[model samples]
Each structure stands twice: as C-alpha cells, then as structure tokens.
Target: MSIRLDLARDSGLTLSDALSVLLPTPAQDLSDLPRTTELVQPFKPFHDHFAAQGFSSVDASDAPCGDVILFVPRAKAQARALVHHACQRASGKIVVDGVKTDGIDSLLKEVRKRVPVEGPISKAHGKIFWFAADADAFSDWALSDMTLAGGYRTVPGVFSSDGIDPASELLIAAMPDRPGARIADLGAGWGYLSSRLLEREGVHSIDLVEADHVALDCARHNISDPRARFHWADALNWAAPEPLDTVVMNPPFHTSRAADPALGRGFIAAAARSLAPSGQLWMVANRHLPYEAALEAHFTRFEELGGDARFKIFNATRPRRRAGAS
Candidate 1:
C-alpha cells in the first residue's frame, strides 16, 4: 500500500479540497475498487462517493473476517477499532486514507503507535497512510466492549451521537398533530426525528433524505417503517416528486470548506416549494441564524413556537388559496 499527504497552502481550507480538484478521476478509480465487505463511517459524502463507484458498503458494522473493509473513522476509538479489524482480516495490505482537515495526520500518528507503517507516505490535502498488520495485533485493538448510552449505541462518526440533539428534540416537540400526512425529513441524520415521526399515528408516509450514504444506512436500520423511504440526494438540488403536506427539517447549515449559511437557506426555499399551498413547514435551527426574515419572505404566515438561548423552532405555513383562479 502507498500513503500520500496533500498539503493545502490555505490554512483555513483542507488539503482534501485541493486533492478533490487535482485528483478527481484517479481518486474515483481508487475508491471504486470491488471489495467483499466495506465499512464506511463518520463521513457521509466520502462514503456515498465511494458507493457510487460500486462497492459493497456497510456503515459502522464490525468488519467481517476475510472481508475487505473501506473504513472512515469519525473518532479516535473507531479509528483504532477499524485499524485492528483491518489488520486481522485483511488478506492484502492495510489501506487508510483521510483528509488532513479531518485530522488524518493525527490519526496516522496514533496508528503508528500500535503497528509500524511500511510503505510510501503520500501527501496532498492530507495523507494516505497504509501498513501491514497481523490478525492478533489487529484483534487486540478491537473494541466490542464499549456499550450504548441513552438507548443509542454509536461506534463513531455519527452525527451528535453522545445524546439527542437539542434542535431535533425541539423539532419533535413542535411536530404537527395532524395524522396521515406525507412527510420528508431532510438531512435526516440517523433518523432520530424521522423515526419519531414514523411512530406518530398520523404519519402516512415518510421520506428520509440524507446525502451521506453512511447516515442513510444508519437511518434505514434506525427507522424500519414500511412507509419509510430513503433518498441519497444533494439536498441543495433534490426536488420532491410530488408536493408534500408537511415538510420537517433540521437542515444542515454548513457545506464543506466554507460556512455556507445558504446551504440551509436553499433547503428552506426547497421546503417552501415542496409544500402544498396550504401545507406547513416546521424547522429548528440555531438561535443566531437569520432565518426569520427568510421565513417571512417565503411563507404567508409564520410563528416562532419555542426556543431558548441556543435554539429556536419556526412554524411557517403557505398562504391559503382562494376559490378557483388562474
């Protein structure tokens, strides 16, 4: 295996960003290789980018013995476990790749503490590090002993896994009482809100739209309603096939490499577009976000239902239409 680091001149931007432009095609080939079983986590876009190339992917599952795993660790603990798993089962060399902005360099240093690396270290926006390992050494680093907390067990790289997100909690509290409505949860990370909505007696159909394949995988397992549908979409570009009665979202606020407040702004615009003329939009967001102005601009009636110092929930409804007109 080979390792390379792509260093970025801009301290604010990750080398991964540079590499994205420099090596899009070749990187595609590398990520597309067929594997028996692959584990991708902690990052959604990378996993989906790889999955698009046709690899059998698993999100945050234990690496099957003899299976070739594509691992992306969101935390130190998960990185260690995947390294351990790879060493034990890998018939080929161990391959570990990460973006410098994501702290792949630090992770590599940690991995080196356990097993020595034995290949060319390559650098770009970050680095790709690989080494050989024996099954015993790998198994020693494995962590099956870790337990769940608050009924949610997360290995690593999941969105806000330590506990329930306050924003989601707020959104759930403010969810419409109307039953049998078609609902879509945009950026439904782990399906926390979506799953709760599914349990609602009033929900008729639910679509969980997550851009990251890894998050969607977790969502599928987390939400099992037959009415649940999953869409891997760039939420910025996704359009609903049909107008929806209710659109519930805790839209993501950031896009990689920049603080694109407009990311969520676009989601808001799309939600407004997707809703029926009389449908409602319930969304939760950080308190400081300048969304009230946007909400007012899009909807005929809007209200701030609940909030505290850190977060706020907005309820916006489209204008009721008058009798038959052009």
Candidate 2:
C-alpha cells in the first residue's frame, strides 16, 4: 500500500513512456505514479478496468518502454519474471512496489542481489524500491514454461499455478464419468477439466473458455486436441459457439483483493444462456456464496450434488431460455 504519489516525490528516476506491470487502478484523489503507455496485465477483468482508466496496454514480452513500474504480484515466479523482463527491456530505472503481504521485501532482497538497489520508501504497509535496468543480470528469470503438479503446464501467476486446486479436483471427482454431451468448461484454467473431459468415454467435444491468455496458452499445450476448442475471452461475456449439452466449471470467485460474487453470478447466467433445453450444468463454488439465487433464476431445475467443508458442487438442468427462443 505504498502511496504511489510518494514514489514520484522521493525517487530521482525519470518517467516517460513507462511500462506498468500488474498495475492496479490508481486510487481516487491520488497522483504521481509514472505515466505508462503500455500495461501488462493478464487478468481479464482488470484489463477492463485499465482500458476504462485510459491506459494503453501491450504484451509484457514485446513492449518497448523507457521506464517500468511494477506492482509486484503474489507469485514469486511471476514477480521475478516481470522484474527480469522489465529490467532487460526498459531504457530507464525500474521501480518495484508492493505490500509486504505480496512479498515486496523478499523481492527487494533478491533484486538487490541482482542489481544496484535504491531508495525504498516505506509507507502504507508496503515498500517502494528502484534500480537501474541491468540487461545482463537476472538471465535466469527469463520466462520459460514450467511444469506443475499432475504435469499441468502453468505459467507463473495463473490461478492455482503451483498445483491442482482441491476444489477443482472435487468438481472433477463429482463430474459424470461418461458425459456423452458436448461440453463447455467456463473459466477453464490450464485446461485441467478439458483434458480430463477428453479422458471420459463419451465426451463429444469440450470448449475451454478462459480469459487469461497466459493460462489459455498453457491450456493449449495441456490439451492439444482437435476436439477441444479454445476461446480467450471473458467468461461472463463469451457465449458458446453453439448451445452446449453440458457445462462444467469452478467459476472464479474474485477479480481483485475483494470477493466478487458478481463474477461467479455472471458465469452462471452465461451457462444458462448457452445451454440447450435439455442441457445441464455442473458447477462448484464456495459453500457459503449465494449463487442459488442466480441458478434458480436461470435454470428450471437446480440441485446441490455434493459438498465438503470448503466447496460445493451443483447440478442444474433445463435452461429457462431467454425471452426469444426457437
């Protein structure tokens, strides 16, 4: 929570055509983080926020920037990758800022080992540090595909990048072993369910729709099958190519630091809209969230299939069909 305005006041670094990585929306009544011509954020919902805020975004690897301001993410691999890439590509000082909760101190220490570290203004439960771009150092951190548990191809910072999410596993276990239906895995991360769906006896086809391009890229690698279609679009906005026979997912529950039930609710509505009359949905959510209202509104039938202490799976059938239908 280091006040970005302080970074401008304290740091001697010049900012022009700057690049912002995993940058958040500037707080209201605030001024003075470097102006970024390009933003590198993989999360789809945040992309909407950045665009609305008038920040031009470009891909992290290819963006040509004079300076960089990195809002360090929680994942060590992702943070390190951004730091290394920015350090290599930017022409000016690279400023790193993040809360201690987000591993700012560790990043500062590791960064000090790699380059000349400078004024780290500590404020608002976070640290803001800077260093001159050393294109030669941190060669080890260049982006490379890494393997996670269960042989899943994951880039750093993708949801559950370190391992298979237990909630997803529960959904997988409860999934129909013989889903003869054409399916859609909304918010499919790394194609875990899509790959598993292919393992079933009668799964006709699976459309893996995920918003994060990095995660979708890993999905492509994980489930490289002609039967598996891919869509890199927001789950809430993407409609199935055709009405689906079945939908299975663990809809994402949050976009930022705050819990967003609206995100999951939007997924439910999308599922209902894209399902055929006889189609069914198998979804998992946290036990306490209030998705029942949405499910009831969109589907003619809804039932809780099973649950554990942390997660619950549901089965909803016979989509209610929006106003005009065949």
lDDT of each: 0.62, 0.79
Local accuracy of candidate 2 as per-residue lDDT tens digits, 1-326: 23653665455655574555545544322223343456676666666666666666543456566877788888889889888888778888888878898899999999888788877788788888888888878889887777977688988888988788888889889877787568999999898888988999887799999988789889999987889998878888787888899998899887667898988888988888888888999999999899999888888889998779999999999888664321
Residue 82 accuracy (lDDT) in model 1: 65
TM-score of each: 0.70, 0.88
Candidate 1: list runs displaced more than 4 Å: 1-74, 85-90, 95-101, 118-128, 140-153, 319-326
TM-score, structure 2 vs. true: 0.88
Per-residue lDDT, model 1, residue 323, is: 21
Candidate 2 Cα lDDT to native: 0.79
The per-residue C-alpha lDDT of model 2 at residue 298 equals 85
